[model samples]
Target chain A: MKTVIINYGAGNIKSIQFAFKRLGVDAQLSKDPEAIEAADKVIFPGVGEASSAMHMLKQSGLDRLIPKLTQPVLGICLGMQLMCNHSDEGQTNGLGIFDVEVKRFSKAVKVPQMGWNTIHNLKSNLFHNINDAEFMYLVHSYYAEICQETIATSHYESEYSTALKSDNFYGVQFHPEKSSLAGERLLKNFLNL
Target chain B: MLTKRIIPCLDIKNGRTVKGVNFVNLRDAGDPVELAKQYARLGADELVFLDISATLEGRKTMHDMVLKVAEQVNIPFTVGGGISSIKDVDDLLHCGADKVSINSSAIKRPELINELADKFGSQCVVVAIDAKQIDNEWMVHLAGGTIPTKHYLFDWAKEVESRGAGEILFTSMNNDGTKSGFANEALAKLAETVNIPIIASGGAGTIQHFIDTFKIGKADAALAASVFHFGEIDIIDLKKELKKQHIEIRL
Candidate 1:
């Protein structure tokens, strides 16, 4: 299977690529819209600020193509946040894939909720065979509020959406690539789909 | 809520893990990739690889080693030691490291902290400080604790946080390798000074030491080398103890 990771000249996608390789899938990283559109699957991964990432996506012309994708496309970390309606990180508008907004965690909890946390209420096939009480790695200050599109929810300072699923589109707030065995299994499930 | 992290650090020289571990089970203790795999399987939250090598060639070798480890180990890993510039951070990040730690170089050019944090988000930059208590003052040391600096532990920690460093790794020079305990007093002081997460390094001989580091030290994470490397303390058992003590830890 040809899996192409969206490369918009922002953030490092090496770990994401290695994760797929470990699953015996050689994924390609490319900014060319044709290559990404031609692939069997596409992964949109990002780190750093939302506004800058959005700006880079726009400059690379990916902003116009990503939301239009019909095949299964997964967004990880910042990529997941950017797939929402908007983000408060830099007051930037997102791709409007998921009808939700990302907001900063209040002073109730730590700013950047780093480390392992459990996600419950697994609803989508994206989490097929994934059991409850399984820990996924999360490292973000902003979270997508619970919405109808939320496929999974996690408890932090308050309950929020950790994963979102729409028709042919999947997004996860945690880094499955860095979450060890459980993560590998989730990727395998996604690939088998 | 985020669980407290337990990190096992590996000191590498010329692409091989530094030797001083007394574990006989590890036939090739110098192999970092093998040790990394072992730690990940043991339920370690994260891993830090410190390249103690001197020559440029050795640094290059460490980069290659990072690639191998990243391919096999499925956990967030941080690389430290001899990182001097944005180029250094970029090279390591490109090699698949989750985070890059700067110590002596950060002290030499404090602005480097802001530079790195700006280029790569603060989450990717970690500033490591080696501190020692001298005359009732916790003074910062440079170049692996061989030299002392004017910066105090609390003062420098606040500065690093204000300068946009994502996290601070504080190691007590006197307590390091002693296994007596973590410098809780200084750790508490530093934690109060910065809102960012503080990783307590050095010491940690027993499971109770880890508990105290979180409870008393107010540390977000506890880091150790010999205890985990020499099999003096098993990570899974230690985490069980931490949970029993009411400290939140990933089991």
Candidate 2:
């Protein structure tokens, strides 16, 4: 199956591409709206400033094309936050794919939780092979506020959405590419879908 | 909740894990890849490989070792020692290292932190500070904790964070290899001050020491070398004990 990873001026695109390559999946990366919209699946990944990222997406018209995709789509890190209603990172508007808010972690928990942390309260097919308390790599300062779309949850200063799911759409705060076996499982599950 | 990490640090010389009583009289611990895989199976949250000779050798054999370790385990691994430039970081990350740590090079050239952070993002750069307490004030050390630097530990830590360091791996040179306990006072000071994650290194001898580092020191992670290599503390039992102490872990 063909997968198009949105490459709208964000970092970590190569790492995610390399990860898919390791999994023996051929996923193309593109900024062209046609290539992304025509793909069998889509992935949105980012690791930089949110406001500028959305700006790039809007400039490329991808910000509009992404939400119109009928096929299964995945978002990672800032990509996930941008799929929500709004982001605390740049205080900017999002694509509104998921009915939730992305807010920054307070000074109490520290920003950019960059390491291996356990994941629990998993509630979606994305975690088919994973279990409660499984460690997944995470590195983010903002978290999605809990809503009907939340599939998994974690806590630091308070309970928040670690994973989000809707029909034909999904997002995760953790980088599944950087996350080890569990992350691989999540990607494989998304592929199988 | 993301699980708190338990890390075992290895100082590799000539591709073999080595340890000493106090950063001297080096004794071989084991092969780098073998020890790293062992830690992974024992539920270590991560592994740190500090190349004690990377700077002198001018080659990153540690990166090669991390490539092998990454293939063997499903956990994250960080590489330190002898990282001087963005090219050094690029070589290591390209070799499958999850993080690259900077120490002496960063002290000599603080801009290296900003450069690496801009190129690779702060999530991949870790600044290691080997600190020694003097007159109740912690000072940064360099040259494998052999030389004292004028930079104050806490001030340098905040500076690194602001300058875009993703995390700080704090090692107490005075307590290193002493097997007594972590320098919680210094760790708390750093953890309390910075917005980045703190990995407490040096002087970890017992499982309780790890617990102490996180509980009192408030470190995001704890790194021990001799205790794990010498069979004093098994990573598996250590996680079990940490969990018993109400600390969240992968196991």
Candidate 3:
């Protein structure tokens, strides 16, 4: 199956590509709308500041195209935050794909909330054979609040949405690419979806 | 809950993985890619590659090694040593390193932290501080804990956090290579000083040391080179012991 990872000069996309490569899938990195639209699956990846990333998306016109795609699309890390309705980081507006608002984690916890955290309340085929409370690597300051689209929840300061699903669009606050074996299984599940 | 991290740091010199005792007396470990894959399989939460090479040619080899490791290893890893500019970080991150830890370079130019955070986001920027207690003061050191700096440990930590560093890796020269324990008192103070995560490095002799680092040190993560490289402490067993101690480790 042909897979394209949306590249808009954001965070590391090579790791995502390598993750898929290890899974025996040669995922293409493309910023072109046509290539992304032609893929069997699309990955929307973002890293860095939200406002600037949103600016790059608008520059490349991906901001308009991504929300309309019908194929299964997975957003990872900042890409996941960008899929929400809005983000508190840089006061940026998101693509409104997940119907959630992203807010910064309270100073009560670490700002970035680095390292591994467990995701529970699994509710989608994206998890597939993966069990509940499995740990996934995460590094982010902003998180989407738990809502109707929330497929998974993790507690840091409090319970927040770690994974969101709204029809063909899916977003995960954790980095499945860097999340080890259980994460690889989730990517495989996305492929089979 | 976010689990406390267990990081096995691999020191690289001329493209090969080496472990130095007390920042000197180097010993070869194995291929970096092979060692990284082994550590990931063994349940290491993350891995750090510190390129101790002093030559320009050796730094070039690190780029290739980073690419290979990123291709093979499933978990997250950080690349450090000789990284100073945005171009350096950009090259490594493009090569697929999840984070880049800056030490002496960041100390030289504090704005480097702000530049990196603004450019790549703070999540990818790790400011590693090497400090040791001198006259009852935790003074920051430079050049892998060899050269002393005027900055205090707590002051530098808070500065890095305000500068937008995502995490701080504090290695105590006094406790390092002792195999006795980590600098729990200093580490706990650093954690309290900054809201960002603090990774405690240095000492780390036994599984009990790991427990103390988390419980007493209050470190968000613990990093050690020799214990893990020499197979003195098995990560799986260490994590199990930490979990048994109610330390919230990934097992």
Cα lDDT, all candidates: 0.88, 0.83, 0.95
- Clashes per prediction? 0, 5, 0
lDDT string for model 2 (B1-251, tens) is 55678888888886788876777899988888888767766777778888877454435566567677765555667888778888888777767677889998999999999999876677778899988998998989887677988999989999999999989999898999888999999899888799888989888988888899989999888888888888888888888898899986767
Provide the lowest-lDDT 10-residue window in model 1 chain B.
B19-28
Write the residue-wise lDDT of candidate 1 on A1-193 in tens digits. Answer: 8899998866769999999999999999999989999988989999888998999998988988999999899999999999999999889999999999999988666557778888799997888889876889888889999999999989888999999998988999999999999999988888877
In Å, residue B214's CA in model 3 sits off its true spot by 0.2
lDDT of 3 by residue, B1-251 (tens): 89999999999999999988888889999999999999999999999999999999999999999999999999999999999999999999999999999999998999999999999999999999999899999999997688999899999999999999999999999988999999999999988899999999999999999999999999999999999998999999999888888889888
Report per-candidate DockQ: 0.66, 0.38, 0.95
Best by DockQ: 3
Score every model by TM-score.
0.96, 0.87, 0.99
TM-score, cand. 1 = 0.96
How would you order the candidates by lDDT, starting with the best? 3, 1, 2
Task: Output the better candidate (1/3) by TM-score.
Answer: 3
Best by lDDT: 3
Alpha-carbon RMSD of each model = 2.5, 3.1, 0.6
Candidate 2's C-alpha runs over 4 A off are: A3-9, A12-39, A55-65, A116-121, B13-16, B54-63, B66-72
Per-residue alpha-carbon lDDT of candidate 2 for residues A34-122, written as tens digits (9 for 90 to 100): 88878988999987678888888999888888888999899998899999999987799999999998888888777787776667788
**Worst ten-residue run, lDDT, model 1 chain A?**
A106-115
